[model samples]
Structure formats: C-alpha cells, structure tokens
Target: MPRQFPKLNFSEVDENVRLLAEKVFAKVLREEDSKDALSLFTVPEDCPIGQKEAKERELQKELAEQQSVETAKRKKSFKMIRSQSLSLQIPTQEWKAPSVNPVLSPATPVLPSAFLPVQVPYDVPEFQRVSISGDYCAGVTVDDYEQAAKSLVKALLIREKYSRLAYHRFPRTTSQYLCSMRDEKWKVEDEVYPDFHSPPEENEDPYNLDDAPDNLDYVIKIKGGIPFVYDNKEMMELNEPRSLPYPDLETYTLDLSHVLALIADGPTKTYCHRRLNFLESKFSLHEMLNEMSEFKELKSNPHRDFYNVRKVDTHIHAAACMNQKHLLRFIKHTYQTEPHRIVAEKKGKKMTLKQVFESLHMDPYDLTVDSLDVHAGRQTFHRFDKFNSKYNPVGASELRDLYLKTENYIGGEYFARMVKEVACELEESKYQYTEPRLSIYGRSPDEWQNLAKWFIKHKVYSPNMRWIIQVPRIYDIFRSKNILPSFGKMLENIFVPLFEATINPKEHKELHLFLKYVTGFDSVDDESKHSGHMFSDKSLNPDLWTSEKNPPYSYYLYYMYVNIMLLNNLRRERGMCTFLFRPHCGEAGSITHLVSAFLTADNISHGLLLKKSPVLQYLYYLAQIPIAMSPLSNNSLFLEYSKNPLREFLHKGLHVSLSTDDPMQFHYTKEALMEEYAIAAQVWKLSTCDLCEIARNSVLQSGLSDKEKQKFLGVNYCKEGPEGNDIRKTNVAQIRMAFRYETLCNELSFLADAMKTEQISALSK
Candidate 1:
C-alpha cells in the first residue's frame, strides 16, 4: 500500500486526536501555549487515531491521482497552434479550449501551471487577429467599455496581425507587414534584459529624492565638453552605420552597417522585412538582385538583397548575435570589452571588411530618397504594446473576453520610467540640457492624473528635473465617459482633484499652482474624429457646453477648440503655465488650429502635416512655436513627402527640436536622437550651424523655467569660474559676443570630431 502523510494544525486537532498525541506533542504544545509555534504543520505518525480522518485522507489521495491521469491525457493530444515555418499553402485556423485563467491585468493573480491545460503557443498566423474598424478613433463611453473593450481587443489582435501578415505574403510582399522582433526566434518577444532604467515603485508615496542616482552632468558634444560614446567594442561595432545597397563608408548618408552590427551578425536578422523592403526600394537593387541569382537556391536565411520568408518577424538581440560572421566583429574583437569578448572567434576562414563586401554574392549600387516614403507602415512596432495578446482562441466571446482581460493592463510606471530612462540616455548623448526633459502622449484622465502623480513623485525624487507631460489622446476619455458635451467639466474634474490630492504646497514650492498639465488626442481632425463615436447631436446635451449646438461633422475641430479655451481658462484662473500639446493631424481647421494652439500650447507634436499649407508654416514661425518632432517614429510610419517635411519646415524657421516620440516602439534613446539628427543632417545636408540651431531650440524651447533657462543658457556654468559672459549680454562686447558664439560653434564641431577619434582610439587600445 502507498503511504500518505497528513498535515495538521495541532491547535485544531480533534480532541480524540489531541489526546492521542498528548504524549509526544508536549514539546510542540508547551505549557506556554502563547502563540501557536506549531505552524510547521507536521503530524506525529503515531499520534492521531480516528477512522473518519483516515478515510478522508484516503479519499483526497484518490482525487489527486484522478487529476494527474487527466492532465496526462490532455498533454498527450495537444494540437499545434502555430506553423513553425512559412510555406506556399496558408495554414488554416483551428479551435482550442478557452483560457480558463482570470482577466490578465497587472493586478491579476498568476495561475498555476496545472490550471493552464492548453499549452498556447506563441503568436502565429492562424489565431483570429484583433481588428479595430475605422470607427475606433471616433469615440466611446466608459459605460461602453465593453464595446470599447471589443475595439481595444481588435487593436490588440492586430498588434501582431502585421507580424503574421508580414510573413504571409512571402518574400515579395513580406516586408510590408514585417516588424522588428526583439528576439531572433519565431516565438513571442521576451522583455529586454537589464531594463534601460529602473521601474517606479508600486506604492507611490513618501519618496526621497536623495535615494535616486545622481544625474551625470551633461555637456554638449562640442569642444571642451565631455564626449558621450559607448565604450563597449561590441556596441560600437554593431552600431557602426551601414545600409542596404551598402553605401561606401565615406558617404554622408546612413546605411545599416552600424545598426545591423549592434544587433545583427549578418544580412538575415536585422530590422523588419518591411524595413528591408523599404530599404530595397530606396536603393537601385536590380543589378544586385540579378547578380545574386544563387540566392534563390538559399533557403530561409536573409540574403543581403532580400529578406527571410517567415510569417513572424525576428530581431537580433543578445541571443541572435551569438552566431554568424559579423563585419563589425573585426571591430569588436579588435575593440570589444572583456564582458562581451566571450563570443567565439569566427567559426570559419575569416575575411577582412573590404574582402567580405567584395565576397558578397552581389554588388550594391546607389542609395537615394527618390522613390522611398517613410510614412509607410512599420510592421515591427508591435513589440512595445503586448498587453492584449492572448492566444488559443476557442470562439468569438472567449476572444472578446481575452481582449477584455487586458483592459487594465496598460503599463504605467514601467512605461513612465522607460521614457525617463531614454531621456536620461539622451542627456548623456548629443543633448544640451543638464536634465532630460520628456513629453508623454496619454489618453484617459486617470492616465493624466497618474502621470501627474508620477511627475510629482519623480520631482520629489529628483526635484531639479524638468519633464513636459502632454496628452494627445484626451478625447478618448471624454468619449469613453460619454462626456463629449461636458469635455471641459471632465478636464476640470480630473486635473483639479488630482492636483489637490497629489501636490503638497508646503513642500513643492516650484509647482505651486499646477493646472492644465496634460493635453491632445489620437488626432482631432474632421475625418478621424468621426471614426470612433459620433461627436454631434446638438440636443443630446444642453447647458453643459459653452457652445450648446454641435455643428455638423466639425465635432473634432469644435471639441478641440472648446477644450483649448477651457484649459486656457483654467490656466488663467490658476495663474500658471502647464504643459500642453495642441496636436492636430491633417488639414482640417489647419490654420485656426495652429494659431489657437500656439497661443495657448507651449509646443506642438507632429504638426508637420501642415506641409500642404505654407501659410501655417509662416504663422508657426512668426508665433515662434516649438515643434517637437520624432523623426524615427514618423519615418517608420508616414510617407517622406508628407512625414514631417524636414527640409521645408526647418527652412521656414519653425523652432524645431528633435525628440524620441515613443522610443520603445522606435528603438530610440538619447543617442538615437543623434541617429535621426544624422538622417536629417545627411538627407538635407544640414550644416553644423543648422544642427546647432536645432540643439539650441531644444534647450531654449524646453519646458525649463525662465530662471532655470537662464541658468541653462549660462555658457560656463559647468566649469569652475571659467571666463564667459551672460548670453543675454548687450554692450560694446556684443560684437565680441557674436565672435564667441561663432567660436563656440567651431569648438563644438572640433569636440565632436575629437570625441569620435578619442572613443575609437580608446576602444582600439
């Protein structure tokens, strides 16, 4: 007979059982019987005596055995959910058991392995994809969160739809739907190791600023300033710039060499196929593709001329870099640090850089912007938003339930710090500010309040820091709550209460009256605004809005206009300026939107859509509005001619500053800003002066206070008693000042070049 041990709470043992254990249990149940120390839950084998107890123990053993057999049976016949390879014939969808787990939220409890009977495979093509129709951006109410839930589910479903579609169309069209994979594998992307920055504490209160790490003093990359360069040989090699159609190293334009080296080993595992496809379009690859006819015989691996034929996107992370011949490896082995030097020497006969290129199956040609468009869909941006992903759908409701499960899973502090960390990285790179300033795009009031609380906490943690938190998706909250008519009321209700609850006047004197902190939406344009929920219905709301009558189809415009007015009113009443992003997409109310927003908003995000209207650019320049541009994000998503209009806008003198908009999605950081700056600089061949002006604009137009701005503008503030006058100087020395500014520019350029030389030398050493 199989022996079974029973666990017992000695204090609660049956009287008869207690009597039986009295002899030996005396040590466990002492005369001091104060606090029951018998929590170890052990039972004396010879103690308890009861037929009923023994029967119960036997019954439990039987039940456990039954479960074990059932689990074994289930495992023996598990069906495949994902196709490991992409082939001509499309795999059909199959039904599976519903997820018996509770809704997935940050707060949701983790389920035991036994509970998850179905071993759901990572995201693949056959799972029903989530799709939000054109109406998703229109509007919905919190009451309609279920409907909102469905739409959100759709958004989540399609998050990886591009991943699957990218591979479905084969090598020819695969690039269109492919996105960058964080890992080189076909499975779901794992979280990046050693997060860029530490996360925020769960309970947000009573924080100490001193506990935070000292922010390293940032110096511009110009001469006499500290050069911020990655010291790791691997980092330098992998990041050494190269492109498809491989441009000469001496060329000014960007190539994939650096980015690929940093992440990938060879041609097959770089960015999304779509990115490679975009690259192929940028360069005249006819000769190369034709020369590499042998590539057709090569299966799976990415030919430098083409891409991999997988339904899922793969990326080059620490894992992928472990294999293959990397051109950057020559640089790494010659320069890589002891940490990453563990990588084995090249497995086969090695070739030098030039020889490696000459040995490629094909010869590459020119790289130009002639037929390329940056506005095209970037299929690889899905790695950042994975909350709603739950595979193995049995039916529609279960899928909907799956989608609904991730509703509260929207990341808060982890995301918040990711932004902060990116800013920190930028601070070390080519950034001008001593402190990293960032602007966030948010949707709901709760998100706004939480951001506000986080900002205060961050301030309390590092008070001298400056952060511009803007909300572009504020309208969704109004629509979700069905308060379109009372949009102003909602802003007031959320912002004011949030301020009162989080802020301590006696403590944070710098932020005395914080109002109108967050601002914008998914794009409040005539066309897209009408996509989510109807903004009209004059009689639907009365006496709530200043304009009781909702004009036909202009809800997007009018709603933004009224909210701007109300937010401004709140600012005036409170007597302070708060961070606001007057974001308007497309040409709807284009001029009026710019004028009103510039007057009230401190800055504008992605306002480059006004490329069609030159007059707006003139007004934007005249108003001296700071336009925050996220180059990589826009480049990955929008068409070149329409995306940001780098040449025209900068030429017109809009106070332009480069920012990493949604860095995680774009894989950008402070240093990445330099990449975008490099792209703009190379494409337009922007002069060093232009780069200076752009850097100046970012510092001057930043959300720093006037006194702090003055402090920041002080030329030799970082040095001890160095000779330099105030930038605002106006005397006989003004002429000298002009020469100094010119000198400063020269110094900066020299320093940048020297930094590069110094870094390379340091590593080469």
Candidate 2:
C-alpha cells in the first residue's frame, strides 16, 4: 500500500510559528534585494559585537547545562551509545553475480571469468579508518544535541512524505532509519520511484503512435491550479472527483512553514554547522590516510577509466546546446547552400535566409564567432539580463527567431537541423548523454501540439538525448500583455493538454509520442528577480491572482508541484511514464528558494545557495538529493569559478554532478560537458577516483532508464554502499564507497539514538 501523509490544518498551527515563518521569508526577501549579493553565495560572517555576544551566551548556557545532574546523566548515556556505535564494525555482505546460466548442463563448458557476471567484493581492502571516542557531545549540551537531532529527523520525515507523495526518490538508507524511528517496518515494496520510459530498440519505430493505450472516460479540469480528475461530466457536475490523492494547499503551506522555522532555529543551526565542518575535516583525514590505496584499487580495475565512464549532462538548454562556433558555421552554411530558400515571414512578406540577414544589415559570409556575439564575457558576469541578450545572434532578434525558435514560418526546420547536428555530436561521443530543456510557454493550448508536430516533422529523436519541458516563470510578462487572464488560465494551458493526451492518446498521438522521450519538467527563469507577495494559506488562489505582479517563488513551486503530483499519479495508474520536477533553484535570490525546492523538487540545478544555510545544506546531504552544478555557466553570470562551492560540497559527500548549462554562451569547445569536467579537474586537482565518482553520480542523477543504468553502472546499481558498486564497471574504488556508506550510517545512528532517548523519557513520564 502507498504511504499516506496526514493532512494538516492551517488554523491548528500556532501563531508564533506562523510569525517565525513570515520573519524567515522577509529576511530572505531583504537579502535577495541587498547589494551584498555575494554574501548569499559565501558563508556569512558575524560582526565583532554580535560574535562576542553569541559566544558569551553559548558559554553561559553550556556552563548551566553542565551543572545539571539530569543533563550529566543524559550526556553519559549519549557518550556510551556514541562510543559503542563507533566501535561496531559495518556489516559486510558478499555479492556474487549470478551466472549467465544458473543451471548448466554437464555437456556445457564452463564460461570464462570475463564472460561471467560482474561481482562486487563487499570485503573491501583494509584501509585506515577515522574514529573518534569519548564525549561525542562535548561541544554542545546534551539537551541541545537532542533538540537538533529531533528537528532534523522531523524535517527528513516531512521531505519523505512529499517525495513519496510525488513519486520522487528518497534514499533507502535514510528511509530505513526513519522507519526504525517510527517503529515501523520498512519494506522494499514501499519504495516509490518515478517511472521513466526506456528508449526504443533499433528495429522499433521511435515515432510510433499506434501503441498508445486505449482511451478512458476521464475528465480533467484545472481549478485554482490543481488538476481534478472525474469519472465523467456527471461527476464533474456533482463535484465528486476520483479518489486520487490531491495535495491540500493548507497542508503544504504548514509543512513549508516547518522547514522555514527549522532553518532559523539557533540550536539546529549550530549543530548542523558543526557537523558539516566535521564532515569536511573527516574527508580530509580519510584522503590523507587512504589516497594511495584508493588509487591502487582503481588502477587494478580493468578497462574502465574516467574518459570511458558514462557521464550525463543533466542540465542544459536546447536553444544553446550548440556552441557559438557551431551555430555560426550552421548559419553561414545555410546561407551559402540555400540563399533563395524561404526561411521566415515578417510583416506578411516571405523572406529568404539571405533576405533575413540582409534586413539586419549583415551578411552570413562575414560572420565570425566574435561577431556573432553570442558568447558570454566579463560584461555578462553578475548580469543575467545582459547574458540573456547574448542568445540573439549579432544583436538581432530576427536572426534568433529565424534560427532558434520552433514556431517560425519554416516550421522550425533550421532550428531542428541545428539541434540534430548537436545530437549527432553527442551520439558520436558515445559515452556522453544530455537532457536538454525545451520551452513550454503557457500562452496557448495549441503550444503542445505544435511542439509535438515540430518534433516529428524534424525526426529529432536521438538516443543520447532525453528531453525536459522547461516552463519559464514569466507569467507576469504574459499577464501584462493580456495573453492570459489569470494564473489559473496559464496553469490550465500548460497542463490541460497533457491530461487530455493521457486520457485520449488516439486523438493526440503526436503529443503522446513526444512525451515518451520527455522524462521531467523544469521551472526556469532569473532567480535574482523578486516578487513582493509571500505565499501562505491566506494567499489568493490562482484564479483570483489576476494582478500583473508575478507570484512569489514559493507559490510557483507549490502549484507546479501539485499539478505534477496529480499528473504523475494519473500516469502511473495508466502504466505510463511519470515526470520528475527538476527545477532550477538556489542559484540566486533568497535562500528560501532552497526551502521550497526541498519539499517540491526531486533534484535541482545550481544549488549554490545551499552554502548560505548550514541546516538546509545538511538536510540536502542527509536526503542525498542530487544537484547538477554548472560552474562555467555560473562564472559567466553569477559566482566566480574559484569561489564555486562544488568542490566543497563534493568533499562533504553531497550528491553533485557537473553539467553545461548553456554551451553556446559559456563554452569554447565542441564537447561542452567534457570541458566542464576538465576545468574542474584542473582547478581542484581532483583525483581519477573523484572524476569517476562524479561521472557515476551523473549517470545515477540522469533520466536514463533502469536498464540503461544497469548496463552503465551494474545490475545491482540500486543497492546501497559498496555492495552496489561494481569497481569493474564504475571504476570507483570500493574503499571509498565503504567509507561513504559507513559515514552516513554513523550520522543516522545518532538521530536514531536521540529518538530512543525520547521514547524512554516519555515512558518514564
């Protein structure tokens, strides 16, 4: 049975808790508009007065806690548990891969070891381990430690609830610990995973529309931005929708408030901050002791290496998938080959490719990479507005429309050709894969069908490329132009067609086929821009939000998440592919954006803002949520290359992968994903194991199917720890995998111990 989350009531929430959430939101909003934008990306520093005062308060509190006899007894008990946990050895499991033929006839000859299944050794080669003993809670009072542990656990539970509700992923290890805390048995069947469609076979048709499931008599209506499914028109009239679990807005806001308040809690902040520091230091010590052993292990592995390990560019835009040189050459080649061919229409006059460039007072033959002016530079740094303009070639929107858009007069032929060319390069690379985001603006209902036709007409299917529908958060622009009457209408335009297609695929064959290759949705836009409205239960529903002012970030995430959740449930019931919400978050603006994403996003891109809040960062680490970082893209628009926290986050055991956000604007080479890895390796002095580990992470974080992952990583790729890692396939050291697994288990053990103490205290009471 699927786990059901308890519905929350807004009125039941304490006023003080609500006030605290409001304060947190306001603080982050002010920070977003502050001149010290760099501070958001770096660790905040306290002034001398505040630092002294904080230290004095902490010291006084510690002294008082030490004098309490009950506190002393609790501290001693905690120390004992910590010491015992530290001394206990991690359980080892021997994984022997099953033979190709389990029952072989006596006449059959034995297969060679190479031909046998790949087996991962659970008994990792012995290496030095870091152990700390005595007074584990020395730095903080036992009471404070327990408080932080309980709060962190509560936050994790909240996230788990959301992940399960939306069919997003939760770490198996963390889920097990959480189950133990609740005294409930965790089962493999309880695990919920998003369903992604696998690619078609070589002999099969990629664009086949005949295999769509039979239509059902389902009615979908978008009311206040939430999709309601009814059995038929009579049920719709009766207001009795099907019993699919729809999220309650009040409950969501209440959950959001809990996380918001957690980030502001003083004790939790200190605990998480210290733990993060310890993690970083612990990694440093582990490296010093076992660096060579890890390298030796990797060296002995056969065939696999950093270059050959499968890596996916998890975050990139379709329009800029091609680099400046590629785009420039394509433009010139089109002009040289088809100067008289009609490519666009403007002012009711058909125009040739040559005429389009001539209108802009330019000739394609004279164009160079520099003159194309699509590449980002120093001027673009910290200036997203200027960086966006770089999308237009030679400072002409006409050229952008002619070559980049999918709805042009020529049915996006030129744009499709360019994207296919980029796809060809990725196919040739063989080891590289990319999930490029294509736009889905909610200005009209026909947008989905148009995009689908464009895809089929161009035969744009690529085995190496998966698609993500990126909905740009520009409702204000549309609303201002009267393109949309209200936010509810926009939501309907975006999601209704998808629901319609899911119900009646025979009528929407093109869209149903296009959606198979699309594995997820992305909420994208400039994060630096701020909206004055704060999202709350009292906030206007989407139907009432007719103002030109854009809804706040939280509002957008919530509505998007709810719609996707319902959509996934519907699709899952029909045995179809489900989409993950991988939004762009934490790149800029308020740190609260990360909070919203914690409950809503499956994984996020550009989590640079995680550096600002230790509590949120620790939560992200515990959940093992994947973050796709694009440093080169950041260097051009937001943070400097050296200041990026990808290295720090990676060292701290955060699940992170490298990606090229925009190859056209930020890259010089044809291989943009490789360029990202090469620079990181050079700058950070990363080891071969580190690069392979990152590559392995990219594959895991991608939308690739389970079958594909098994081929790339191993058959048992879903298992946790060293048992899951196939050193032969991944080229990652078993020693490193064991260390990571042990460290995480150690952290979870502390939380579990805290819960046990709470149970005992309640029993005593």
Candidate 3:
C-alpha cells in the first residue's frame, strides 16, 4: 500500500480476481487519498497510461454502475409487484405472478391475465361429423321405467312392518347430510307415523312415560312410487310444499366402501374413530332406534326418519345400522377377503357382536355405559353426516403438489412402464385392442408426447388397441409451479400432434375415443370459475414447458354446441363419427354443456348428479348416452353410501353402466369394477340380477364395433338359467347365495313361529 501496490494490475487477473482487485484498489484510494484523485488511473494527455487503457477502465466502471442500478430497480419493482398483486380483490385464492425477465435472470415470470377464449365468427365451418344412434338403449321407454319402478317397489315392500327404506338428503350443498330419508327409517317419520304420539306437557301430561303413543298399524300403499299423506288431511296439502312422494327413488348397495373413506392417520383419524362408534349401537335395536330419532326437532324438516321392521328381506346391513348381525359379518368378511379377495379367505372366526363391540373402546373393566350403549351410541348417528365436510374437498395446493411430483415421471421410463402395464392388462383381458383412459387436466405436452410414443410402440404388438384420452380444464388459475401445462401449448404442441398421428388418410379411426372434458365450473366463487378454456400465447412465460396453465378442450359446452351443430353438414362429406366423453358433469348441466353433448358423447362419466336435472337426464336418456358411474369415486368424493344416485338413474331408465374411476387412487382392486359393484351392492342392496344388467351395460356402452360388442355380450349372457351367463354375475350370485339362502331360512323360521302362534287362534275359533 505504501508503494501504491504497483498501480494494481487488474487486467492481468481473471474476471473474478479482477473484480476483487478493483474493489481493493477503490478502498485504498478512498482511505489514503481522501479528496485527492488517483491521477494515474485517469487518461490524461501526459499520463503514463494511454487513452486505450483508461477508456477500458471507464467502460468497466460504467457497466458496474449500470448493474448496481438495475439490482436496486429490480428489488423495488419486485416489492411493488408483490404489494400490488396481493392487494388485488380476487374472489378465489390469493395469487401473484411476478413480472420477471428471463434475460436478466432464470426466475419465474408473471402469468398473463387469464386470456379470453377465442370466439368463432358466426360463419365458421365445421370439420367433424358427430353422431350417437342405433344402440340397445334406443328401445327403452318411460313406460319401462315406470314398470321397473313398480317392480322395485314391490321387492322393497316384501317386508310388512318396515316395508321399505329409502334415502333422500334434500338441501344438497357443500356440507351434506345423510337425512335418514334414504334408509328403512324414512317410512315411519315422513310417510307413516305408525307409533307416533303427540308429546305431553307437564300440565297436559299423565305420567310422561305412559305418554308414549300406542302402536298404530297402517298399511300404506305406494302409488307412483311415493305415498301421499293427503288422505290423513287433504287440507294440509295446499299450504305444504309439493311433496316428493315415494316409490322412494332410492338404490341400496352393500358397499359403503365407495362412499365412506377410512381415515388412516393424522389428526383426521378422530373422524374414523367416531365412525367406528356407530358399531357399538348394535345391542338394543329399539333403544338404538330411539337414540337415532330423539335429538333433531324435525318440525320444519319432515324428510328423514328410522323405520321398525318385523320382516328382514331388505333390512340386512353390514354396518349394524339395519339388520344388526351384518356388522359382525362385514368385519369378518373384510379381514377374510384380504387383498384381491372379497370373499372368505379362510373359515370364519365367528366373533360375536358383544365380543367385537367390547374390543372397540376396550372398556371391559368399566361398568357404566359399558361397550355397546346402544341407547347412547345411536344418538351419535342421528346426525350421521356430521363430518361430511371433514375430508371431502381436496385442497388445490394438494393437487398442485401431485402435478409437480407427477411431471418428472410422466415423459420418462416410468411412462413406458405404465403403458406396458396397460398393454399387459389388455392381453390378460384377452382383448385384441383395449383403450385405457386418462384425463389431461393436470398434464403437460411432454406427457402426452410420451404417451403417443409408447402407444405407437405398443401398437406394433397390439394392432387393434385404441388410445383414448380426455382433456378438460377444471380450474381457472394456473398455480405457480412447474407441474401443469397451459391450455394453448397443450393444443398446439400436444393434442394436435397426438390427433394428427391418430387419424389416417383413408380411414380416420386410429383413435378409438376422443373425450373432450369440462369440469369444476360449478364453483361457488366466480373468481375460481373456469367455464371454458382461456386461449393464451404460452410462448411468453417459457420458464417451463410442462407447467403451462390449463387450457380448454375442443369440448367446452358452448364451443361444443357450435362445433357439433356445424358438423352436421359434414356428415355427407366425410363418413366419420366423432365422440366425446365429458364427465364430472352433474352440476354444470346447462343446455349448452349437457344438451350439446348429445351430439358427440361416447358416454358421460360421473353423471350421478344428473338425476337433479330432469331435463338433462331425459335428454341423455333420449340420446341414449350411457352414464358410466364410479360408485367408489362418488363415495370418496360425494354421496353417502345409501344416497348413491346410480339407483335413481337406473330407475329413471337412464342407460347406466358401472365403472371404476381412478381405481388405484381410490384403493380398489385390479378388478376395480367388482369392488365398485361390491360397494354398490352393499349400500344400495342390489341383487345379483341387477348387477348382471349393470355389468352388461358397461359392455353395451363401450365404443366397440357392433361385431365386437355382440361377441362380448354373447359370451357374458348365461345359457344355463334365467339369469345372465356373465362370469361376474355368476361370482356375485355365488357370494350372495349364502345371504339369500340365509334369508330364506330365517323367513321359514319366522313363518313357523307365526303358524305356532296362530294355531291357538284357529282352536279358539
């Protein structure tokens, strides 16, 4: 420093070293000279340093100053952007997209404001001809539904005392309820109060205990499916809301498995523990029934109730809620039928109700409220749907995580392996060509590209296999993550290529199914609403290709309507039929969304909620667009086990088929449909014959050729008996044969007791 460090040779040092040397030299100049400038550094006319060297230093100093200014500017801009973005009043989740420049840094860029969907001119021409006609359901009539309803009612009313049970949870909202209207209980409270007694006041009371009403035996007739209470007092009808009468638009299945989710761990495990408490009420059926009825003052709400059944044809329950013995059987069955099995894996353990109930709380030493306090426990179930909101709605953040984690594997070797697995499954099922369905809501262009490649490779071995895919936009905003791909890029870079590869010049039939999907538009918040796809030039925010925001499918309702209607003229030009599978469509059934789908739907998935919209249901029924319902998915998401709308759809004479949506995620077996059928069978209490018809509908609704469909159905139909010859039905019948046989034996025993009781009456006469 004393010698001025030989003028600090920064030029000889590397870029990083020179930067350090520059800082050191500047500090020395400030500390040593203070006010005096280092005249040697400047390019003076007489100085030893040349203008060339001085100019280079000056240029470097200018560059450094520019960088410092930019750094300060960027910091201020970032803070301002965040402040402004967070302050905005958006109805959905709070969001911000920083306006970052890629040239400056490799950071995230501000997402463009949601782009408006491109609207077509009124004179746009159509490209594809869409059609759905000439199917087995074409013969179904309203009269057929009425007859089926009648037969179903007759079957339900086979028991005299309880007669029937049905479920209807009206006031359907985000937070739902079971509303015992869907159980065997609905008959007593809402329809016929056979043992109803007007409560006693202290003054008007005799003993309050004796104030209980006497048994009132009433045989109610169900006409048009529902029994009108008008005869009790025809005058009350005028003031009351038009009553929804009952042949009870209800479907019973044995499996609550689809509808009821088991909380494995975490704090939410408390909900599962509470759910298990329902089992303790298995002891005193009458006491339990009272508890089930006591609390709720249903003065204004007359739609839910519990029924007393002397007969047990349809009362058998696996949850001990109905036929008490079912709880123990269901528990044992679940264990015995481990893994792929839904039947007994070994001989029964024969654990009695008392033994199991004791094991629940394990208070064998406690005296008061001992394990099965049927009286107290039943009260807990009165609001059976208390936890409806507990674990239902999946957080957007969670789905975003899935997208992020899923992206790395989507276009890699894992993709190949998944496709190979599908190939193997097709081979196992003995199908020449099989279509495995996938949704494009949370996917990137690479994912679809990878799929196309693997599919092409697979087609070498399986020529007949068809690749069917669905693309839909269920969310309006793009989450700030590198998981999802945007709508525009997907179409331009993904779907267009996939489709181009699929369509052949001579025959445009390489793609077996093209499902344009739209979902999540029926949101409560307007900000979160994404009714259609937003058309954006994704080229701007190019930090990630796979994380583009969701875009619309060619299947948005309004877009679909215009396209399909326009396509009608193209039928003569190209003899091609187009199909679309729009699912998660129950609530968003506008004339455009639902009615429009009639033109192109292969089948609609999760049309369970379609029952609410009568017009939509009728339209789909008229169009013969089969409803592919996944009971387990519905259970995990919505609808109580007893409140499954599949039965209602079937009763409406809707073309319906059983399906397993996201079976692996829902933890269903490889034969996912069977588990669905199992749950549907349990909660809806369906018979083997009904299951066969449902199973058959799946094949009927398939997008197979006539010959293929015929061959498939032919192999399924039973030749030996009145029932269908399908192996699935055969298996169900065998498992259920025990239940039916047991029912028959119990009925005989009851009949024998009745005969013995009546013998004295005949003698007295």
C-alpha local distance difference test of each model: 0.30, 0.86, 0.30
Candidate ranking (lDDT, best to worst) = 2, 3, 1
TM-score, structure 2 vs. true: 0.95
Error of 1 at 355 (Å): 49
511 in model 2: Cα distance from truth in Å? 0.7
How far residue 438's Cα lies from its native spot in candidate 3, in Å, is 2.8
Q: Which stretches in model 1 have alpha-carbon errors above 4 Å?
A: 1-413, 416-420, 423-465, 472-489, 498-592, 595-600, 641-644, 668-670, 714-765
What RMSD does each model have against the real structure?
A: 34.9, 5.4, 36.9
> Rank by TM-score, descending?
2, 1, 3
Error of 3 at 481 (Å): 8.1
TM-score of 1: 0.36
Q: Which regions of candidate 2 fall more than 4 Å away from where they truly are?
A: 3-5, 11-13, 45-50, 87-123, 759-765
lDDT of each residue in 1-765, candidate 2, tens digit only: 654457887564545677899999888777667657555566654421237778789889999988887777777667666665554434423324434312111110111111122253354666777877667787777778888999999999999989998889999878878887787877777888888899999999999989999999699888888999999999999999987775688888888888999899988888888888889999999999999989988887778799888999999999999999999999988999999998887789998878887888988888899999999999997788899999999999988888999998888999999999999998998999999999999999999999999999999999999999999999999999999999999999999999999988888999999999999999999998988778989999999999999998889999999899888888998999999999999998888899999999999999998988889999999999999999999998899999999999999999999999999999999999999999999999999999999999999999998889999999888877777788888999987887888788878878877777864464334
Write the number of the candidate with greater TM-score, choosing between 2 and 3.
Answer: 2
lDDT of 1 by residue, 251-314 (tens): 1001111111111111111111112222223222321332132222122122211111100000
